[model samples]
Target: MNDNDKQQGPDNGGSNPWMKNLLIWVGIFLALAVFVTIFNGPAQPAATSTIAYSAFLDKVEAGNVRDVNVAGEVISGTLKDGSKFRTYAMVQDPELTPSLRKNGVVITAKPEDGPPIWQYLLMQSLPFLLMLGLAFFILRQMQKNSGSGAMGFGKSRAKMLTQREGKVTFDDVAGIDEAREELQEIVEFLKDPTKFARLGGKIPKGALLVGSPGTGKTLLARAIAGEAGVPFFTISGSDFVEMFVGVGASRVRDMFEQAKKSAPCIVFIDEIDAVGRHRGAGLGNGNDEREQTLNQLLVEMDGFEANEGIIIIAATNRPDVLDPALLRPGRFDRRVTVPLPDIEGRVKIIEVHMKKVPIAPDVDARTIARGTPGMSGADLANLVNEAALMAARLGKRLVAMAQFETAKDRVIMGTEWKSLVMTDDEKRMTAYHEAGHALVRIHEPASDPIHKATIIPRGGALGMVVSLPERDSYSYHRDKMYADLATVMGGRVAEQLIFGYDKVSSGASGDIKQATKLARAMVMQWGMSDKLGPLQYEEQQGETFLGYSQTQRHNMSNETALMIDSEIRALVDGGLARATEVLTKHIDQLHLIAGALLEYETLTGDEIKRLASGQDIGRIDSDMKGPSVPAGGTSIPKTRRPKGPFGSPAPQGA
Candidate 1:
């Protein structure tokens, strides 16, 4: 933000300069009232004491009264002794004035003394005027909080950042480099339109940013504001609609009008799908507030009167549900997908956030980035922040690689829940379950490399086995899918084999859920079922503008449903049988790995392999302290996104 933004002045915040000046005027008027009361007050009687009327008459008879002025009162006079005193007289005292004249008193008559016309008016209206001003002030403040003067519902809620907490220029943004480049070119063209116009090139009227959450879509828009020396308006799509019927359309019109005023500006509408959803999804009456708002917006963007010099930048994660008209060539023609950053991009993101913390010389961002696959730019930033916090908690001088490793685990799995204590039998059962998953994965040739195996409780899982893909894959092959299913099922199989059929605990609940999801997606969505014969068997739930209570029905007949169910059951049963066979053949190796886990509580893939090979893992007595965050197994749910080529280590468990 530049001085221009700062110069917009504080809005709905701090003290209003106009209000401050009004208060000063109020103070000035109050001081004037005090002065008027002091100078334009009733004239004093010039008397010290009240004397009886008879005494005044006696004084007049004795000729003690020298001069008197009857102001419809007794009189005011100075005695011959040069001492002044005053006394009240009867209003209908006809003898008073005559007595004064007979006594040879000097009679004086003058107009009554009072304040001037302007001063009198000022004093009288001061209270009413102050009250009126205070009422106006209260209304004005309420208008600021409520909306444009009392009925501000029609005014645009699109907010212009009067002042940003900190400026975010293009230089600070990292990862999503391609998306950044696209936005930068737009800002560059805006900075000098003639430069690009020389080639008969016109900048796109709108650019839609499509990305997963935390992929820096909004941040890219803000960076545009920082790079371009033009006005930037921001508003959420949800802000346009209200309960009032015509309010949303009015807001759309008002917002565009404002943009027209600030031409050559960027207006960023966040979550545009909220209002730009497929029109027919709402009330079919066609007069729905959100639909009307969308219609107005569509018209304003590319309608009869072209909104020249205005650019709309909108961000949304769910672009599939947007209306067709909203995505046409004339409006939102440039679609920029901010994909999850690849490993190199992730390393760069880490480096950017690392600059804010004190880092040790040995800290390698690439190592951390490699370990933390599928992390978006926002996630990487959080990782750095978490690492710094972890170091601080440990009272370390600087953040170390060890802290980053711990932080990555914490972000993915969760911090170590040290409070839960397990009996020896329970711990052994957990070890066998995790070892079964690891061994099953190792046997599957197409499966990813085992990253680690741990029996330590993390999140809601007693133990977990994790895998590390050498490179990211867009789609899974059948062999790898089977491997995943078998590995997840291994826990239950191992429990059945070692602890007997009835002794299996609920520790395999997550494993069963993961396997079911994988197998269902394979049979229904991926067409991996041979009996389904590559036919689509399941349809998605009804499309919703919002999560309304839409009925979810299966169009398939009961026999077809039975076949689909049988197919899913067969796949799961096969996975379980395969796991059971693998464990039965490798019983000795299973006990070996479980023994290592029981001793050390956690083991990396390399250590587990060493145990299986009967190699001396001589570091047993040294550096065996568990990490602050429970190191997760690779069996965590992997991200299915086609881009990024990174792994997802969610809280998937054995």
Candidate 2:
């Protein structure tokens, strides 16, 4: 198998391969030293002979011929009573002779010869052998520590998927039509390379899949692999980092080399922004390791002589922070945006998941899709699974529409906190607060009608009023902003109208804060304020991290800040007044709705409509029955009107 196909093993404790190999070599040298020492032979003596002076004393004892001649191998002088003699001699049945002429000397014969060949060899080789042993030990340690024998830092960390592993095709991925179309060409290039070559066109070296989390970016990459029928290599950006410097860069090189060997293969890097951040943008001298890795990646993308049929696919949500070099023409040539699925996309996603579930005849995918706006494919899949689980919990044979509806609500709102205890006074106050919002929305000729209202505590709120548009809308006009502000202020206005004072609580704090911010932005930032003229006080770029730094605008007088504040307050006050006016005109209607809420603790949009028309609560006793007629069959007032521009009043009770 190629280096890319080799699965990464656990770290071998050492930071570098040289260190590990150094340790191994040291161990081998030590083992060899112990073996040689155990098997070495014993020492031997030298063969040279020694001279003997005792022969001269023996000749004196023999007393041969008055004076004995002493002849030795190099006698220095004649011996006297107190004199010394220096000579090399050997006693071989020799009689010491004293010279009769002038000086008499006793002589002993001496032998001269060198040591044996074995002794010479031992003396000469001993020092050389010790030096050789020391040299071998040092070399082994150096080799182990240097890691020159192993691939070391150049190993790739990418994961390889073989044919045994299940593949993911386009059929496995649902939703995101635009992204699929963009990636289809990549798959085509991998499947049939000559097709692009014929046109003298090169396949895009890389494609960046940008989206929020759980939008199926990684899944799309796998689908490309399956479509092309090529090997798939997967790794995270974090895998490249190591304690040792330059390891990340080395890993990048190894990964590219592996990809080249397995020609026409895909390399999928998930969350690549972890290591591919913009260079020279970090604090201090900057992260050396990450920068080096990014530099190596640049080389692999466009610096190499040829890519050799290798395609790199990277996924990240924060594409804005990536290095510009990484996104250049020859590198990430195409950027595919995978946004949250719209209504129709959600329907298809739900249908894909529903096939595995036993859905009842009444269950409708389109209805569920409409109910869940701005849901990603992952969210839709979870919804379907949740619905099926709910049906199973109730011991039902199949998933019903009600189950899916309840699942949708559960996903949006928290689970039903039915056991949450509240005093009668608190419940009454909640009813008035929610009724205030409902009544203002229903009465305003420009406000969108309410879809549902409930005083039952759910998802930490004591009450909720859900206002949904009849159809999806993209842009908002001035009147719509005014209507939205009025709806937000309706609760506070109702409290003051009914109780003659405002009792503030944490529940309405978020609403009040959001409404005030929007109003201020409309005046200061959006130039929606009439008195402020057409100046944009705040500049917003729709960045995820908002307001990273403050810029000094051209100095303005204190009067300007005060004027902006006054304009914002004036705008919000107008909305509050409008809400109060609408609620006052329908005060009796508000009381009827609040009374129904106190009894049922919840009410649908239809129930609120009947109550607003002054219909008696006794006539609408059943939940399923249509609005009831009075005992004398009196017709209710048709106060509901069609909505205007900016989500204006759509006629109620339609």
Candidate 3:
């Protein structure tokens, strides 16, 4: 038989064979008992005779007799005291006749001769037969305990998948072009081992797939196995460990042996870091068990003999925490990183997942990909399924673009908080707060384009202004950084501009924290402050308990720390001043947008643009219906100082 038949045979060998044998043995034993009972009929008398004695007073009793025989129910016999006893016709009552009560009679007589030799032998061997049966039972139990029993604990837990079982090929995995290309070579090597060996080249000992969870590392490994048409042994690292001490090492050895036997095989270990954590890193009496397992794994990976035709592939998100020995050149050899997909990669992933789904013609995967920047392949798949489910819930025949959009919003934010209660004053404050962000983004030329603004509460946010880049960008410029900071501070600036020092809520806590971090990084880390002299004041110090220490702490004096703090504060103050000036100039337009927001509860970027430009509020244009803007129209400008910091240009728009 082929390898597939062999693997399947072993999987079913233990239980199926045992059951068949057990049933056959049980049938045999039952048949033997039945045959023995049928052949061995009721006991028969050798001679007919009768014996009699008084049950109460048996000093002497007499009856007729016949031939002397051991199997006879009644026989000629004499009492031990030399009294005579007839073996037959001793009873006159019908109930006491020999034919009526055959074995019920008790005679106080001894036979002239002892029982027959065969009967004596049968009686003597009873204890030996019982002893033999007991010994057989113990031997059977011992045999069961030796093999296919508790001793089978040393068996490997890896599941063997033959060529026909793992049907997933490289075609199924999408959006990981580079990873796929690298893995394709491994598959080629597995298929044609001699091609690489002829050139004195050694196949990589192992390849570790490093990525965040749900990035399809395991899937890629399976695809490689499918492409190579080899036996795939799939297991997790945790399967190697048990409560016992040596079990994990034994399991590792057994797994490697099995893989070696099944040559041209791929051993896929998911979450390898579970068994390969950094040695001697634990605090309380180092974990000897895990360390032992890791040592065994290292030996198995790179021992005296090279593992030809046997390839090991492991996946882990926490590759950084793995032991250094496992990652050395001769062991893991190669590490492939699978990061979150870019826009194009996300589009490919969406397309791969959407093939099974019935989607509307207008449902654009590219648009969905552009909206979801940091989503992984798994996330895109989930998004597609979620969109399909939303369509089904709405009783649509196919998933539409609107459903995908809603799913994107649900994934980014959360479900709509329709039941959340809010007073009119709170709603107005939220509208103004959101309007502040929108207006600031519109006026700041370097800021990303505003997509939409809403006073409707979602994901616990009372209101939000969504701004997105026209295209996906990898790098951020300094002007964009400054503009982002201005947008972050817009709400506070608007509150101060309109209410003139009225009560301000702590709703901007996250905004303040982010803006502060960015401003501090600009000064101390990025060296945006000219006074700092382009020095990196932030020291990373390699994953310390607390955050990185500032360079000024150890090297500089208290006066220097004071100077650094002052510089940082000055930088942030300048950004806040710019935000204030812009908000103050556009105060009228801000109020108008805020009023419109309070009435409509939501607004697109075009509506805000028209209101800011002092256009009459007549019919809503088609572009204003959504977030689209008029072609070639520039956004409103930020308030600029005329000559110096003292005098500035007044806001021109409504």
Candidate 4:
């Protein structure tokens, strides 16, 4: 630690964070108190000079009243001697007025006067004013949450970032070097436009970043603005569209006008597919809010001059769905594809993310990258974060290699279902099933190595066998596909040999589905089938709007479809037969592996190989002697069963 950090004490020099918030709340409370005190004023004393009814009548007859004012049942007046008094009189006193006039006292009769003008106005208008204020507050809250209100429908909701707002330069981004290089030209042009102008070159109007989700498209756009030290205006495609037709167009104009004002600036539109979809697609109703907005956007792009300093950058995962005009040369002139990071790219990404974490010395970023084959940039970031969180949860000071491994498994295979319960028979079956897969994968030279085997329930699996390649493979071969099929069928074959056909569980349903898909792909897509020849039988039509292929059709006849199905079935059956033969030859190893699984619950590849090798050494003596002669030599002798997962005696061959 540095000396300044070490010398720091509890009484720090910086301002307290709570001081500002506390002052704001205190001011609000004081204002509310003052408002309440002003509205509810102090109380007044009662008048003590009120005379009785008879006394009031007597005084009216005696000419003591100089002037009398009758307001409701009370009479208020000034006496002749300049003394003021008030008295109560009944409404039935008809002679009171006459008596006052006979005594020569001036009398007037009128209704009671109301309160002061200020108080009166306050009573009548306060409710309406409060209601209006509440309505305005509610409208503003709605605008904040929904991004638009009745009055603000045409206002641009673009988020403006000053030059200092986003400090993310090119150095902050990694894993997509090609995309960075493609954007470097724009950065240079933005920094010094005279160099490009001298060469008679015009900067591209817009650049569209296309990639899968979590591929760092938005981050790269921000980096471009950051490196150039220019203002960045960001908005989502959905921000332009509204329920009203013209509002979308108005918002587009406002956004462009803002971009123009902040010249030498960049505007980023995220998820542009929401507003830039293909026009007249069969999807929406006849109303064209999105189309009108897109039209306005096109006009604004075309209206800009060559030397105008504004540049637009848009991001979308589905570029195929955008309007054709948006992709034209004058609009989005450049297209940059940000694909998923490869092995080396992943290693770089991991290194960048690891800087934020207190990682252990043994945590090899390159090893972690190799373990994660198909992960994107965002996925790797989340994996690192998840590892840190796991380490923190365990009360560890540093994020270790084991934590990263656990995090990778959690991201790929899902959280372990530790609470799931299984019976002894089911657990035994799961053990044998997983062990079958391990044996086939270990023996097959073409298949990837088995990394892990576990009978623990996770996600939708009662048991799992994971195979990881030694290195990343970009292409697949027919031999590898066949080996994969055999590995998939191994579990079912083991169940059939051990517990008979009826006792086999339905846990292999996923395995069968995957095996069938591979088999069909071989026949229809890969054209690796001997009977089907080297012709494509199925065609995948491109999506009309914005989606995956709408449908796949078989161009061949129904008879040919039958043949394809037959070929798929033949491939599966052949895989099953091959798996049975391998399992039978290493039947002792399979039994030994299953027993190990029931004891350990999970096994690494190295542990499985060690156990299998030890069992092979013991079986060499038995293999030298010819087996007891059988008619077909297909059946094998069964060994004594060990204790099952739930401590029950299992069947002999189980």
lDDT of 3 by residue, 1-654 (tens): 755676667666575766766775686576556445434643335542344434312322232222222223444443444444444434444444353234333433344555567656655664466567556656656655532224545556888776656578888888888988987888989888888888888888799999988889988999998888778999999988787887788888888888888887899999998899877775436757778888999998886233378888999987767889999998888898877677778888899999999989998888788778778888888898889999999999999998998887778766756655565556656667777888888999999877678766667576778775667687777898888888888877776665557656666766677778887778667777777767766654432233222243347678767777887777667767778888789877887787777655667777788878876434443423544323222243221212222321111110
Q: Quote the positional error of residue 253 for candidate 1 in Å.
A: 3.6
Each prediction's TM-score against the native? 0.80, 0.69, 0.73, 0.80
Clashes of each: 5, 26, 5, 0
Deviation from truth (RMSD, Å), model 4: 8.8
Query: Which stretches in model 3 have alpha-carbon errors above 4 Å?
Result: 1-153, 162-166, 284-287, 304-307, 541-557, 614-654
Residues 296-385 of candidate 4: C-alpha lDDT, one tens digit per residue? 888989999758888899999988788899999989999999999888899999999999999999999988887888899999999999
Cα deviation at 344, candidate 4, in Å, is 1.3
Q: What tens-digit string does per-residue lDDT give for candidate 2 at 455-506?
A: 7555657677876565555667888889888888888777778776655434
* RMSD score of candidate 1 (Å): 7.6
Off by over 4 Å in 1: 1-120, 142-152, 161-170, 181-185, 303-307, 545-554, 621-652
Model 1 TM-score?
A: 0.80
Query: Every model's Cα RMSD, please?
Result: 7.6, 15.5, 11.1, 8.8
Q: Which one is best on lDDT?
A: 4
The CA lDDT at 98 in model 1 is 74
lDDT of 4 at 394: 100
| TM-score, cand. 3 | 0.73
Positional deviation of residue 24's Cα in model 2 after best superposition, in angstroms = 20
Candidate scoring better on TM-score of 2 and 4: 4
Q: lDDT of candidate 3?
A: 0.71
